[model samples]
Target: MKGAMKALRLHKTTQKIVDGLKLETVPIPEIGPRDVLIDIKATGLCGSDIHFIDGSSILPKFPTILGHETAGIICEVGSEVKDYKVGDRVCANFATPCGKCYQCLTGRPSICPNRSMIGVTDDGAYAEYVKTASSALIRLPDNIPFDQGAAATDAVATPFHMISKRSGMKPGDTVAVFGLGGLGIHAVEIARMYGAGMIIGVDVDDYICERAKKLFGADEVINSRKIDAVAEIKRITGDGVDISLEVVGVPESQLQAVNCLRPGGRALMGGLGAAPVAMPNTGIFVRREWEVLGCYAFENLEIEKVLKLASAGRLDLSKTVTSHIKLEDISVGLQDLHQKKGYPIRIVAVQD
Candidate 1:
């Protein structure tokens, strides 16, 4: 508990597949006055971490610890911290927004340009211990498991923000969610939670599509590789869907998401692909009155709400997790995610 801890780290960004990360013994970070030291219990793998490892610009810098979805028990608190104490189970907001920023002042702290995100701009929870600002931590309720608590940071909180704040999903709206990854799977659950009349989940893998329908409350499942997603969606819901969420941020997926929307529908984009998107003619957008919105991370309030919901059994996301691994098997987990070896919604790395 006092010395070095095992961690998976990206020494540098690389194009070579799975070569960017290495298991290293690093010192447990020391907490500052406004920070707390967390003995991480669980951390979920994210697609963005793959981008960071593969030399993508998803992260601001390299040679840093890379995990955002995390939950743990507090082992130590800084001198300035008082509301929390040792042995407290908690998950935290991934970034600490500068309260003085214009976006923060405007009540959009998730988009604050000056925010410092865990695993992107600072050392993250992939290691045995992580030091984070006290203000970012949220206590996990007694009933929620640590992995589920970890998932609240991104998997649940993100889609909650998108559906509740960005997409304007209503009680009976039809929704098409493209990409059944961690984020997209949650999109389905959240859509159902909001009383979606028809929830369609789109993914290339047939297994994922099946899981989305059987486990995640998706009313319909579309295999993008087998059929034209946009056409199928239009056929399923006459005049297109009421809302479309593009969880995969590639140009093609973005276009498909836009194309699958009704004339006056909204498209909420959450993916972070690097390629530039080609939009339809300006006149088409003008004529249709379709709205396109971009969603970033999540708000602390939303994360707290999701945690509370999960704790109360109102939101059941335990089925979304596919595998639980140890810190040493990170490469295998990353490989499974990268190669599409299995239709894994989430692969969590638990502390050894």
Candidate 2:
């Protein structure tokens, strides 16, 4: 805990991710009385990380390590931490919420105004070591590998939160997932796991669309570039889908998500976009009783539930991890994600 460790630090925002991030030796994060120090074993690259690099997402401070989806071993424990000890395998809930805040007290801690997010608001796990509160830690079962455990933290958990908690997707409901990226692709799998009657995946990339159908649980896939996705979805489902999740974070995809919903159906927006999305026609929306809800990241307990599901073999993340790279090659992974080079579902940075 005393010596320096190598981390990929973001000095500034740049379109070129490699230019913005510098891999340098920095002091290991010091722990507080209620904190724990982790030796990062596996971490994942996400679309939000790309958004930070492209200036679409804003960071509170610069020179911060940039990774939130992580799993590791506890190397040190704080004096006041009672539940956890060193050498425990764990994955973290990146959002650290203030327990006394109004949102936290009301059981909506995911949106706590006082919440601090790892990688976004503070130094994260794009390094050899990272530190977070003991409350943010969730025990990882021995059956799960570190890379799968890391992906479960965000790539899988976020969509599970959106579909299971926010979307109101009942068994046998028709579901449509927009964007076949990391989060969206997982949405397809979660929808199927929840017993969706039909799961449709929408994306511009043909490769991702095909993979979602074959590997993930998508029953149908639509490439928005070649055809009218909304019309096709309506034709397939007979009156649009029961639940539509927009994880693309773009105005067009968000609008399409709303449009491809049945009357009184829900549209859960999980993607974060800098631009304002145009509101739907008020007359039609009000008449149809359509609901558009915003879903933030998963709750801390949800991460535990996801881990249990994975451990029980109810959820499969085998294909979710597209590839693995070394910590030094994080920039390359980010570039590959940004360029959609490999149609990656989740590219993880694992210990070499």
Leading candidate by lDDT: 2
Kindly list the per-residue Cα lDDT of model 2 for residues 1-352, writing each as its tens digit: 6999999999888888767779999999999999999999999998899888878888899878999999999999999999999999999999999989899999999999999888988899899998999999999999999999999999899999998789877899999999989998888988888999999999998998999998887999999999899999999989998999999789998989999988988999988899897558899899989999999998878889888998999988788898999999999989988888877888999984
Instruction: Mark the regions of model 1 whose C-alpha exceeds 4 Å error after superposition.
Output: none
Q: Which residue pairs in candidate 1 collide? A: none
RMSD after CA superposition, every candidate: 1.4, 0.9
Using all chains and alpha carbons, the TM-scores for the candidates as numbered come to 0.96, 0.98
Q: Residues 1-352, candidate 1, lDDT per residue (tens digit)?
A: 3689877788777776467778789888877898988989999888788888886666666568888889999999989998999999999898999999899999999999999888889988778888889989999998888888887789778889999889878899999998888899999998999999999999888988998899889999999888999999989898899998988888888898988889999999898888886467789888999999999888889999898888788899688678898877776787788777767778889873
Q: Any idea what lDDT model 2 has?
A: 0.91
Residue 43 displacement (Å), model 2: 0.5
Best by TM-score: 2
| Local accuracy by lDDT, each model | 0.86, 0.91
